[model samples]
Target: MRQVPTPFPLSQRIPEETAFDRRELAAILSLYGRMVAAGEWRDYAISHLREVAVFSIFRRTAENPIYRVEKRPRLRQKQGMYAVIGPEGQVLRRGHDLPMVLRVLERRLIRSVD
Candidate 1:
């Protein structure tokens, strides 16, 4: 009997994790900073998965995230690649541009100012 060698090791065979690029992170962080300064957002987490990247915003460290910004490259053609999801798992906004999609959070900043 002969054994066939895999092209990639088992540890590396899965699809590469998707993540936010430098420019995307910069834009997201800029909004995060503003929200933090406004006292509307307190914490955040970033996650890279096989098919999506997420940036979750939290009002407190121990609570569930209040909002989540997501990137799904697989949806880039049909429904855009970016989305803003509310705490209840509702889609607040979706678009191809990161800054534009993030305007949903900016609205929160507006409400906080009043």
Candidate 2:
């Protein structure tokens, strides 16, 4: 009989740290909460990958995500670190400052007073 080989452990392949920090989360979640209260958003998800971290927002559980806030460390030097992508895969904004990048989404909160 032939012997079988066991697979390696998962932890060994993962990195030690994440790209997004507490300050970034705070800024993102703060806006998210406000949008939620406004009834513009309902669900959200977070993903930390080897190259990037993504915060996805959805209007409903079954529907596709409305926006994706991504943090890519590699792009920090080139096109800033934070980026907000629309549902259609277009970049709404990209900047080094998290709060500034997020401002693009906040603009949607405005409405005509008339």
Candidate 3:
């Protein structure tokens, strides 16, 4: 009889945690919904890395992200915890509160219909 190979032990695996909490996701999704309704955004991608978490927004699935929302726990003490980056690699906004930090993107939702 052939024996099945066992997987590696848990101790040898990498360990990591997500940066954003449920509340943070809720706030981001809320804004995303609004932007989607306005036809401003089409898709989004999320990545949780060892040092930071990023929420990337794209106008199309095949295109590059237009905005990125990031969370860096290490920056919590110096420059708050959250940051919003534009397509040009500029720091649009940064603050301790996720919602407040995201408000910079929300401002783009405004339009004057003449």
Best by lDDT: 1
Q: Could you tell me how far off, in angstroms, the CA of residue 27 lies in candidate 1 after the best superposition?
A: 0.6
Most TM-score-accurate candidate: 1
Clashes of each: 0, 0, 0
Every candidate's CA RMSD? 3.5, 5.4, 6.3
Q: Which lDDT tens digits does candidate 1 get at residues 1-114? A: 999985877865656898999999999999999989988889999999999999999999999999999999889998999999999999999999999999988877886435
Which wins on lDDT, candidate 2 or candidate 3?
3
For candidate 2, write residues 2-106 as lDDT tens digits.
999988799556564456789899999999999999999999999988889999999998998999999988788999989999999999999999999999999
How do these models rank on lDDT, best leading?
1, 3, 2
Q: If both were scored by TM-score, which would come out higher, candidate 1 or candidate 2?
A: 1
TM-score of each: 0.85, 0.84, 0.84
Residue 27 accuracy (lDDT) in model 2:
98
Instruction: Give the lDDT of residue 41 in candidate 1.
Output: 89
Cα TM-score of candidate 3: 0.84
Off by over 4 Å in 2: 1-17
| Model 1 misplaced regions, further than 4 Å | 1-14, 112-114
